[model samples]
Target chain A: MKTYLLKWWQTIRISWSKYTAYRLNFFLQVVGPFLVFFFIKYNLWSSIYGEDTGQLIRGYNFDEMMQYHVWTLVISLLGQGYAAMNLSEDIRLGRISSYLIYPFEFWEFHTAGFLSFQILQIFVSSVTLGLAIFFGFLDLPSTMTLLHGFSFTFFMGFFWFTMQYFTGLLAFWLEETWIMRVLLSIVVSFLSGYIFPLELYPEWLVSGLKFTPFPYMSYFPAKIFMGVETNFMMGYAVLAFWMAVFAFVNHLIWKKGMRLYTAAGM
Target chain B: MSNKVIEVTNLTKQFKSYKKKPGIKGSIQSFFNREYTTKKAVHDFNLEINKGEIIGLLGPNGAGKTTLMKMFTGIIVPSAGELTINGHRPWERKKDFKKKIALVMGQKSQLWWDIPAMDSFLLLQKFYELSDQEFKTRLDYMAELLGVVDLLHVHVRKLSLGERMKMELMASLLHNPDVIFLDEPTIGLDLVAQENIREFVLDFHKKNGTTIIITSHYMADVQALCKRLVLIFDGTKAYDGPLEKFEKILGNEKTVSFSFSEEIGGCDFIDKYDAKWNECRNHVDIRVPEEELREVSKKILDLYPVIEFNTEKMPIERVMKTLMTNPEVLRQQRENLSS
Candidate 1:
């Protein structure tokens, strides 16, 4: 609808103000990781062979590893671009209850909000990531890749990002979700391939990851950039399977959670 | 066409409340004890509201007023009941249903707290998916009516309470909802702010026949805007009737107050007249017996040089406090918890 497009545009116009409200924090957020990743990649390459040498292992020579780390670091910026709070916060603060009185469906409104934030995140993070990559502090094997790796990353990010949303459902029942948040980091680091690449992991872990969506978010796409793209059809198959799994699981939890959700003050 | 826009049958809500023990040890023990409490928040309540009707839901704290509103909005599921709004079940939360309803709470803000109100309005436009012409027309009208067009550019956080409330009214009415839920919309605001909102609400109803269901601890809100009231005392429908009937039944008899220049103890005239009285440092306050207030006031004025005197009745706040806490009423209230 023309109205809908106008509305979406209006939503983004104020995003600059929201983003600028925490300019210092946002800039620091980008730069902090930028510096850390640069040092880590440099140290990794040097430590692999000798002080003067480059490369990590057999397949990944010094040049390749250096490039890979730089690229991955830029990629990691996408994840941090997200500004999200648990869905439970909406319930806890009575915002969800207010939304209910409106004519719109709850999930539809939430989806709109989610889509809005994601668009904003992608825009802001891409700028930051591009800058980081341009500075030559971080590098990844490009292979002149256009949409190959990027497109896969997009699907993987969506599939895994939804998992975070479902995890938001846990807040309905749990008095405190601190433990869940901590454990979530481990899951993200493990499967999203933040700490280690999927190929570098033990064979059993890599195989096991295939069953979950986390690797699609971080690891699979990282490999694609390293010239290790999966079979396109197989990748789509796995992506579709994870999407279905996440959707089914999320729907199930949401249906059950609504019955139990007080949407009242905690 | 029938005037009724809201209909309900035996509406009930029961929320699960997890009990907590005091200390860490008690918490561990409770895990083993497996204790939980189920609170019956709203019970078997039935009502029919016509379009253009503004009804007040009056209760003390935790009286299930908010819960009832939430149910109508389809935010909270009722434990057992049937509720329909404009012929649609509220819980279905259909697009038509959403377009016709709006909710606002005074204590909580729907406006994005950090951004200017205009920004928040823009987001609301998307949520409601209003056409540009429709959005602009409504925005202009609401701003004109509420006198908040200039204020829109200011951040909501920077605005005063009254300004924020004005903006809130505009935001809620952006879609021109046919049904409005006001949960303490005037709470914690100054008298001026309260009056402004009340005026806007009354005018809104007059113009659009928007059925309004308002809950507030402030009885003035009810007194000024609502003719019929549903009083929920302790999570149950304690009283449901006309405002005049509620006042008459709940002993809405006027109480006169006077402040003497000195610390005067008890009033002998009050004793003689059998009038209930309170004396605290230079003030002699009396709850005028239903029939004898004016006659007694005359005699008092003749007897003592009353430094300050008013024949006005006691405030609604005091009336409800006494009604809820009195010993005889408390016993009766508990027995008929929900009917």
Candidate 2:
């Protein structure tokens, strides 16, 4: 446990240094999504309400609609690296081989590394979120009220990170991993409500998606921030269950895959 | 007392199949029916290495030298072998097993590429939980022994091949493992650098009394550091014994060539010396047993026909080639060729 803590501390140190060194790119990663969604919001509103459309949107003024878009963008930050395919890269380069030889559990290293990267993400996301708050562009509740929303996002982020690692390990079995990643992206995009609200889905589809690990990735975070009228407790329970399942499944696959790990060399 | 630091009884590892053939048709067909090909990499290997002994594993490519090394290091499991290293089954990956040994591959650098090599050394120091004083003492000792003190501050990518290798050797030894597995330590090094490494390995073994297992393409490394070697071919042991005995089994015979000024060769002269006229113009080749080489060379020079001549030890390449194919050699050494 002491070694594990030390290693995690080291990983955080490295990531913190990397984040500071590449400050501009880290900032751009957060801000880039805001700009993207702003235009997307403008286009959607113009289509629905016409040229004379007031800043009002979805029955709210232009500010409200823009705020919704920005909220969704900030929520989407939780899903970014989960879909980035870092583990698949590790598998190809045989970087994972180094972990296999060590005494630590592979998942422990993955989690610690992810946590460090997420530590950096917190700063980047906060800046973007802070900007929205400053411009009166987002409706953040008082610190006490937003605490519930923050916890919801943190657990969901943790769950999604584990699931993402499990999905990436599938690259060991797949020949061309892009196909699997695309299929996963489509599922997450539609089911988790990255593009739209989960409530927008029909009754059966929304219920079915509630069973998937994807909602813990994007939908719950969005719901928390937007104060989407739903059972937050229900979402958290479902996220916890999926996290346990992903952990169990990841353990099973890793145990089986190790028997097949034909390490690359002459 | 434990007489052996490493003991094995028929250790074998057969890798399972997981990579599917590409194509839509094949993928669909294989969804219902799966095929597996188990490659038995290390097969029925048995040996007992005592403490402080140096063992050399020799083989052609794909002869399972590395497979044995990996199994010993706990990186891979054996399919059908009972082995113990430092009273532990290596595959168990116990902290004790990890602390007892370090594995180094010649062409691979475990040093962090972007950072100074000392950082990696420091990490390993922390990893092994060495005390600050102990770490410094061992670090200084290894750096001095391996001649890498000057290269510690340089990034691994900036160091030359020899300098990086020296650093690697120093890093692995920093923990003072009871055993060290070197897979091709002298590869990609010049003759001088190879000699330096060879000398370090020998002196390290003598000083630390650490058992060593080295697999390399350079036979000179084996001849210099290891008196005994285990030769594996096609995933099985071909020969195991002292270097001189293996060389004798190899029949280190020599072929001497004499270049005559004139192509006028006669059978009368050839028969006296038992020389054969090879395809070379004005060149006569003679095969002499290693013991009789001196007498034959003296007699050949005394003959009037000789113009210029040179005697050389048989090349190891040809000797191994002949040894692998010789019916007599196989009959004497009844080891299976395919594991």
Candidate 3:
């Protein structure tokens, strides 16, 4: 166990060095996208509730709407920020051959990389949250509510990781996987209420989406941060079940992909 | 215990690829209905390597040398057959099996490009479970031997190709693997760098008694290091034997070239030996049987003003060239010997 832990620790350390190798690229690639995205959402919401601070759209005043979007931004950075871009490229270019030869398993190395990225994301998200509070876009919630929101969001990160890994593993058959990732992002943005509050959607659509894991990913967690949703059990159970399902499916896909792996272009 | 370190039987690997025609029309048509073809990259290949042997795997491009290397290292699974290395099935990819082997490809860099090589070595130390002392001792030894100790802390992307290759060798050998597979380890490098790599490999092999399989297009590497050669032709073993025997595969004839002081007409005696003359007829190369080499050379010296005479420097090179151009020569020789 000691040796195994050492392996993970060393890999994480190496990953940190790699991530921070280029200071400018790291700054631009990580925080730049989130800032631009939040800026656009902030403008779009302001225009929709133009010149009227008292307007309420689906039980959300303009201030409430801005607060909700701020939480979504925070949730995005903390929960669904990790992408498997390098994973598919590694498989496509035959770089995974080295990992296969190493004593460390490929998934273990990548999981350690994810852990390292999550650590950095935590720092970035906190800074963003502080800036939001300073700008008066958000008020400090109770400590218990803050703790509960963070705990649930972190759990959602694993489910997002599993799904991204599934798409990344499709490199065995598809020459380019970025299109699939884009399609998945668009669908998730619409169904998980990242674009608008689920309360504004049709009743039938919201009820149907409850059967899926989409609501628990962004909507439920953001509501928790707003202190408007208290039913944490349902979100936890739904996310856990989907995580298990995706994990098992990823295991089977990896097995099938290994059989088809040619280690091309080495 | 058996002395053999690697054994294989009836190993085969087939690769399937779809064909697409040229232009947009062809692409659209193929998108609807594709034609797939399967080619055998390695077929019914069998080999047994003993401990402490450095064997050269020789073949032309696309002749299955890399495929065989991949199979031996478990980078890719074989379509069929059985293979074992160090008492472990490589494709199973057990932790113990991975710990006992290393593979280095000349066309690929396994070291993380963004970080210093020392960081990668540290990561590998943990993966291989090397003790702190063991790791330090091995790192120092290899660094001093390869003269790359100063570059250990520099990022790998900043290093030259030759320097990166040395670091690659150091990375793969840190664990003292029992078996090492080198796939074109000196593909593109200067003469001095190539010689340095070959010398380091020999020194490492001598000290550790590690079994090594190397595939290289440079005949010099084969002549300098390997005692035996395995030739692959179109997914089959064409020749497998000692280096000297492979050198004389075409025939047991010696090629001796003589340059005369002046442009002299060819003598009748030289014509009997099937001599090839230069434009001026002052220089000629003759092929003589092994038994008659001395007699023929003496006769030529007595007849003409021989300014300089020398035997072939690299016989294996000429043999490889001949076999590559006309593989039928080797086939005919085998048939004649069997008969």
- Tens digits of per-residue lDDT for model 2, B1-339: 987999999888887664466899788767877887788888788898888888889887787998888888877778887999989998787877788798777866666676678877776675666778988998888788777888888778889999899888877787789999998988899998999999988888888899999998887888788878788877877778777776656454677777776664465644555577766447777777788788877875776467889864435445566765663575455543343
lDDT of 2: 0.73
lDDT of each: 0.72, 0.73, 0.91
TM-score of each: 0.88, 0.84, 0.96
Model 1, A15-53: lDDT tens digits are: 546655667876776466656766775676666667634
- Model 3 scores a TM of 0.96
Sorting all predicted structures by lDDT, with the top scorer first, yields 3, 2, 1
Docking class of 2: acceptable
RMSD in Å for model 3: 1.9
Total backbone clashes of model 3?
0
Cα lDDT tens digits for candidate 1, B252-284: 466677766666565576655435445445665
Model 3: which residue pairs collide?
none
Q: What DockQ does candidate 1 score?
A: 0.56
Q: What is the lDDT for A120 in model 3?
A: 77
Using alpha carbons, what is the TM-score of model 2? 0.84
RMSD to native for every prediction? 3.8, 4.4, 1.9
Candidate that beats the other on lDDT, 1 or 3, i.e. the better one? 3
Off by over 4 Å in 3: B280-282, B294-309
